[model samples]
Every structure is written in C-alpha cells, then in structure tokens.
Target: MKYISKNIVFSVLVLSFFGISSLNAQNDNSKIEQLIEKKRNYNQTEVKSKGYIIQLYNGNETKAYAVQQKFDEMFPAYTSKMKVDLPDWKVQIINFKTRLAADRALNLFREEFVGANIPKS
Candidate 1:
C-alpha cells in the first residue's frame, strides 16, 4: 500500500509539472502576441504635420505613375505620392518642411532626374 501511494504521488507530480509548464507557455505566447501587435500598430500609425511638396509631375496618369514608381525605386526611404488634382494627375514628394531639407532631398533626386523641383508650398 505504501509503494502504491508513492507511485500515485509521483504520477500527480509529473502531471502537475507538465500542466504548470503548459500554462506558463500559454501566458508567454499571449505576451509575445501583445508585443507583436504593439509593433505592428506603431508601423501602421501616421502623425501629420505641415511640410513642403516637391512636384515631379502635373499631367498624364501613365507618365505620372511611371515617374512615381521610378522615384520609389531610387529613394525607398522617402515616400512618393500620386494624386488627382482635377485637370491634372499630380505626383509629388512631401514632408520636407525647410528649404535646406528640401534642397538636400532635391539634390539626390536631381542625380536621377535633373528637372525635379520644389515649388512654393
């Protein structure tokens, strides 16, 4: 009877050990999921501010898309946007608030397309 009790106790301990470990594993997975969600939200969220616009195109949808794609390929760090401003398909680069910043970005852009300009914004 004492030997049977010891075997039963050992079985319970082994089962409890696995049960507690599985619970802790579940808690760890929840924490990891929450961290991943926080990181994903940070990357998707955008904050707005006043800035300059560097005009690259003012007409022709096909030509504007081509230019936008080319700009994106060359400067993946900077965002290139295309919009319809009625009577024209507009392509522009945004977020350069200062003349020096705009000029510096323009210099890089000019290396590929010499005609890129930062109009009054």
Candidate 2:
C-alpha cells in the first residue's frame, strides 16, 4: 500500500511538471505570434523613398535623347531615364539604392561621360 501511494505521488509530480512546461510553452508561442503580427503591420505601412541617381546630361530634348542612347550603349547593364524639368531635358541613370553603388557607377561613367554626376537632392 505504501509503495502504491509513493508511485502515485511520483506519477502526479511528473504529470504536473509536464503540464506546467506545456502551459509555459504555449504562452511563449503566443508572445512570439504577437511580435510577428506587429512586425507585419509595421512592414505594411512602411514607405521607402531613399535612393540616388546619376545625371549624364542636362540640355535640350534632342541632346538628352542622344546622351541616353550613348549611355545605354556604353553601360548596357544600367537603366537610363529622361526627365523634363522646365527648360532642361535631363538624362539620368536611375535607382542606385546606395551611395557606394552610385559613386562606383559615377566613377565608371566619368571615364566616358564628362558630365556624369550625382545631382544634389
């Protein structure tokens, strides 16, 4: 009878330990899920508007197109764009995501395009 009682007490203690550990695990999972949801909401509302561009030419439309064409031929890997800012038609290499990337491209461009520069923003 004493052995049976001792076995029962030990069984209860082991079961209670596992039960408490499981409850703590479930609580940890809930906290982790809440953190993930908050991160998702933050990402959804974030607006990314930082980057750099190198302007190759700023002149008339005819010269802008000519510069863009020449730039396209020289640096086929990079994408070029033209923008009309009032009196000047600007030819630019768009979407350099970092200053280092823009500077590297600018160095290469200066070898061929004398006017290649990153415009002040």
Which one wins on lDDT?
2
Cα lDDT tens digits for candidate 2, 37-84:
998897668645478899999999998899999989988999999999
What's the true lDDT of residue 79 in model 2? 94
Cα lDDT for residue 53, model 1? 75
How well does model 2 score by local distance difference test? 0.91
lDDT of 1 by residue, 18-119 (tens): 999999999999999999999779755743446777887788888888999998888899888888977798889998876679888888888877668887
Which candidate ranks first by TM-score, i.e. highest? Answer: 2
TM-score of each: 0.56, 0.59
